[model samples]
Target: MTQMRFGQGTNRITGTVVMDRRTKCLVKRIQPGQIAVIDHPDLDEVAAEELVENRVRAVINAASSISGVYPARGAAYLIRSGIPVVDRAGADIFCRLQEGDRIWLDHDRVGKVGESQAVVRGERLSAQTVWEKIHQTQSHFNQTVVAFMENTLHYAVSEKRWFMRPLAVPGMYTQLKGKQVVVVVRGTGYKEDLAAIYHFIKAERPVLIGVDGGADALLQCGWKPDVIVGDMDSVSDEALCSGAELVVHAYPNGDAPGLERVEKLGLAAHILPGMGTSEDVALLLADQEGAERIIAVGTHSHIIDFLEKGRNGMASTLLTRIKVGGKLVDVSGIRHFYPPKTERRRKAPLWAAVFSAPMAVAALPGSFTIDDSWLRMVWLSLRLWYFP
Candidate 1:
């Protein structure tokens, strides 16, 4: 384990174990054997793999939010891989506590700040300053990415022809009749979109659908998803198993890891395979399934959004959007203008009965635990068999 160090006050939340531009960019720039200070302490498997593979030593989570909420998948991956993580006492708070900043990590719960030795008036820290972040060292690497974007187009080639898809669609009015369906996605400005979802849900009782990482975002908001759709890589296993109906957004090439994960968890999923974007598939599912109104959250609507995701082509996405444009509602900022529609709340008892009526008749309970989980999962699958 590396010794703790502190320096300077910046207003961004500290003690988070996140892998952002700061960490990735810094890792590429620093010399072979120097400590890298990170403001956020969160990591996903891919980013965590990068840090460990790079042989960077010691990370200081600068904020409590990294510890308090959301899946610290990257941080957990680091710990599980034998990387040393110094808690909320890294660069963020250390700088703020200069001379006698009084480290207060819940003095009542943990008792007394800095139970370990304190280096008062620590050598003025350098590196890890927020204002000094950069993207890459190699201009060639920058050039390659720029070139990819310059050539990127927004149409899908089908049978030697190209087509465009709409990102938003107007759904059949019946889809929104008595239910709420909120599709959550991971995009730039997602926090803002999440705020919109929070307001929409409070005002309208729509079912929440997490589109891959957006599902994880919903969990952070304490909103359970009614359904989750996407490729499974960015989402956590816990979210996939969170009693939400899983819809595997299969690539036109027939790849659907999301479906496989759902099956592995003994849950049911519908494999909707098409070329285009995962969000596009999600909207199609809502429209095809007769969802009264599909309210999308965290969907990409601009060139920068696609570029950030490394989407070199937007043909399928554009065309998919056009296909579903009629029924889809852009609720990205719906809260600002439309007050949530008021309707009689569906009785909780009805939901309970729908979920429990089958369990009530089963003479044996534990004997069917495995089967129930499996059965509940495949319920939609079976429904597709009959309905399709």
Candidate 2:
């Protein structure tokens, strides 16, 4: 419980990195010469590489798995680079912190006014200044992403398995007809969505399913997924431990590197190696599993949602929509569903019991007197039964 002190004033945030967007991480935010913080637990390698190239001051893992469980490669790399990480709170905590809200690392190690301006102070920030820094950082990020994708694709192609089903396009998966299933995706407000999923499961009892990264969310909530379909990035070790059926999407050329991670986890998972995006693969699994109504928790259908996840193009998604039009029922907004409270009734059984007890007391009248404790118990039961 270390407290941070900040002058009651505002400061410039030149070197500060803001990973507030939950859907897709911002490359510019963690660019070189900036202090980086990830608002989500699941960060793709692409995002991690960008932060590394920039040499960020400190990284705050605002995800639930910040310290309780084993850290992911992204956070691990930051720690290895001598960049301190303080995982004090979840993603929601970022909204309260300001640009100059005096950040203290690891409870009280490195202290600084959490402002981006500190990035370009020469003595503090670095040699790169202004737009050039952004340009160079983005350039490195692009190259890294290309390399990462190539390596991933190579590994995917190397692993050939039966469950691996290659889709015709990305973001397009087969649809199901009548099986009960839930489509779990990473939402902006994931914790809230997790709560909703818990309630939804309690009421509907749908076969809990996770779409790629969402499997990790399910694991966080202590609900083992019945099935998991995705490319395999951003999913944690606990997710693989869920023992749910796994389907890996492969490229048309038969690349499915995500399957390799599944294998590395020492768990046997089904690989539906396909060419589609992870979401598409998930839908395909639902169809293959014969799921009836698909209840999606944090899926993205709108272009904005895709963009937030850093997708440059949407043709694949549009085509996929056309393919699975009927079977898909997006419940992205259903996170607000809460169970209603029980109502009180006037004709409660407690009143009948109360009257019966009084009659019994009257019948035993002239001879003996009932104990006060018994009378109190009767009155209490009457109140409880009569009230909600």
Task: Give lDDT: candidate 2, residue 342.
Answer: 33
Model 2 segments more than 4 A misplaced: 3-177, 336-388
Tell me the tens digit of each residue's lDDT in model 2 across 213-313.
68867877777887777777667667777677776767756677887888888887655555446776676556555667666677666533543454543
How large is the C-alpha RMSD of every model relative to the true structure?
A: 16.6, 15.5
* Model 1 lDDT, residue 365, Cα: 56
Best-fitting candidate, measured by TM-score? 2
Q: Model 1, 192: alpha-carbon shift in Å?
A: 3.7
Where does candidate 2 have its weakest 10-residue lDDT segment?
118-127
Top model by lDDT, which number? 2
TM-score per prediction, in order, is: 0.48, 0.49
